[model samples]
Target: MHELIVSPFLDGYLALRPGHQAGLRLPEHRYRELQAAARTEVPLPTWFAEIAQETWGLDIDGGSARSTLLVREPSDHGFSRASWEINLGCNFACKHCYLGLKEFSGLPWDDKVRLLDIMQAVGVVWFQITGGEPTIDKHFQDAYRYAYSLGMMLTISTNASRLWQKSLLEMFEECPAYRLVVSVYGATEESFDGLTQRRGAWKSFKKGVDAAREAKLPVRLNLIVTEDSADEVDAMVALAERWELDHHVYTNMTPTIYGGPESLLAQSSKHLRERTPFQGCNAGHTFFHADPHGKVSICKVGRDDQIDLMAEGAEGLRKLGGIADKLMLRTGGCQGCQLSGSCLVCRPLAKQFQEAKAPLANYCQHGQQK
Candidate 1:
């Protein structure tokens, strides 16, 4: 039987109401406000019961209820949080993009509206807009306004080229929850333009970053390391400091499951520069991805007939719990790999291991942990 539990914040809200009635205190009233509307009245016990029921969508009893006493579920602010890889169209022909095809094809604006509507219905408060470049979307301005109307906190990842217009930055003045993340491929135009293969993109990106900063907007600097630019990490970090921005940098590997892993490997840095920590992975627990097709998968790389992401919604992540156990228990190529600490585990890597029946070679031989 599946277990059920109440979120701590939801429980706290339930406890705050009168024993006989469920109510929420209004910020202005300074008194309890009844949960009853003209049509429906909710009692404290039943209100808590409904929330628990919604969380797991399962029948819960005293045994499950008692377990809640041992722990408090994380607070549920009731803000729907979602991230979208909006479109595949891009200005740069970057070498590392795992999705090889570059085209303007994307879900129509109407479909996105349906998605936003679904998020609002679920009380999602946060939304992340990602893409080939969100700024380049012809309908982005409209999409942003629609999401803001529904009370969503927005985060966007872009190359930061198209948003260089001061007018564009000004449009965000009323939108406070919006934060822009600009991916800096290189520290200088010489390094950056060479990698992006787009002339003047460096200048355009800097102007956009400066414009956003001038508007008093929060900004983050994101960078991906490739074999060609692996040596530039220090320079990139220094640039981030100069700009007074938060920095995120990671090495790239073509996802093994995706057919384009070869393409990604060609674009990524062959030399390993750093080692990531070895920990039991929490795939479905930490984060998940919903593709344009509306199908969810374990991690972004696990696209298969068995991983039905559409059915799970946010709670579907639970289906993938203890995945590390399955990988560890398997007596296959992944069984005795020395780079276990550095392996990018998932169905893709697992398939690679199974097919080759050998450990996937690490590009940076010298960089391997001894």
Candidate 2:
């Protein structure tokens, strides 16, 4: 069957099969043209009609084809999209890595599948498979296939060092990911290896990108800007452009999700936010994060308030939502703070400081000066 999937973050829609076997990206203007035509009983746009025909072999002008078309919008429930840290293990230990290294085995294959089932049942249509590196998981292929079979749009976040592997590349070729968000640390071998702390990771990363391109897989680059890699930002962007890939630049660094100090050293004072308005976050309302061990929380940063996903199943989601809502509630201190206009602190981070009864000197510039 063919369906129109609308992303809350993007203004357009994608026409995709239930199994995600084939799809077409429809820009906002084109999507609007189709919608307007549908409402006014005008003929479908030539581009969309051609794409639909090519991608799904559906002739929109045909009555039978019209009956088979479906439109799916983002879930109005607590969260429409969710991310899973498939495993916390990694081959490269980047200095700025957020999760930090931990010794722990991930849930069993069956358990991971069960979690995917639960997520699907709860109206989570888009799933982001991430980790220290998701491909490092032994059962990543199995879990990924299971999610794909369940008709979920999957996005894989990786450093791209392992994408050259025959097995991993094959899995991606068979069940294509909705997108591969690859993290590029630097442009040159010296700079890249310096940030990743892996002697030959730069070569592997380049090979992985080449392999993905050779296989015609969709890839997006995320330029991680840190103190060590700042000099290569332009080069990294140039590399992405050379590969004809879309990219985003990230400069903010946070303490490890586990609340460690390692990530603090990697922070760039120039990139730190001096002031941010209190517009609230989408954590509990429309997004959540699941760690490798099945601990579900509202977001990656505020991971302390969590519930066991395997133990509670869907009920765990409810508890998580409640916890997030409660944590987001404004406190007396936040309400009366003089820096409310320019304070970069959010309720969740503020809650972390309150719990520790210590100032988050690394995060808050104004508070630190005070």
**Pick by TM-score: which candidate is best?**
2
- Candidate 2 per-residue C-alpha lDDT over 1-370 given as tens digits, one digit per residue, 9 for 90 to 100: 2244433223346566543457677676665555454444445556666777787776765333333344444333546679999888888889988777844468998899889988876667678999978888889888998887665788999999889999888887777678899999888999889888999999999999999989888888998888887777789889999999989988876656655667666666666554455567778666788989888988877776688989988866876767877877657556766666555667777655444344455445455664
Residues 70-169, candidate 1, lDDT per residue (tens digit)? 1112323232245666676889877666556667766677877766665555444446777777778787777777776654556778888977675567
Q: Where in model 1 is the C-alpha error above 4 Å?
A: 1-80, 266-274, 277-287, 305-344, 347-369
In order, how many clashes per candidate?
10, 0
Where model 2 places Cα greater than 4 Å from the true spot, the runs are 1-51, 54-78, 273-275, 330-335, 350-362, 365-370
* lDDT score for candidate 2 against the true structure: 0.73
Instruction: Pick out the ten consecutive residues of candidate 1 with the lowest summed lDDT.
Output: 13-22
C-alpha positional error of residue 296 in candidate 1 after TM-score superposition, expressed in Å: 2.9
Considering only N, C-alpha and C atoms within 3 Å, which residue pairs clash in candidate 1? 79-124, 79-125, 80-123, 80-124, 80-125, 226-269, 227-268, 227-269, 227-270, 296-309
Distance from true position, residue 263, model 2, in Å?
A: 0.8
**Candidates' lDDT values, in order?**
0.55, 0.73
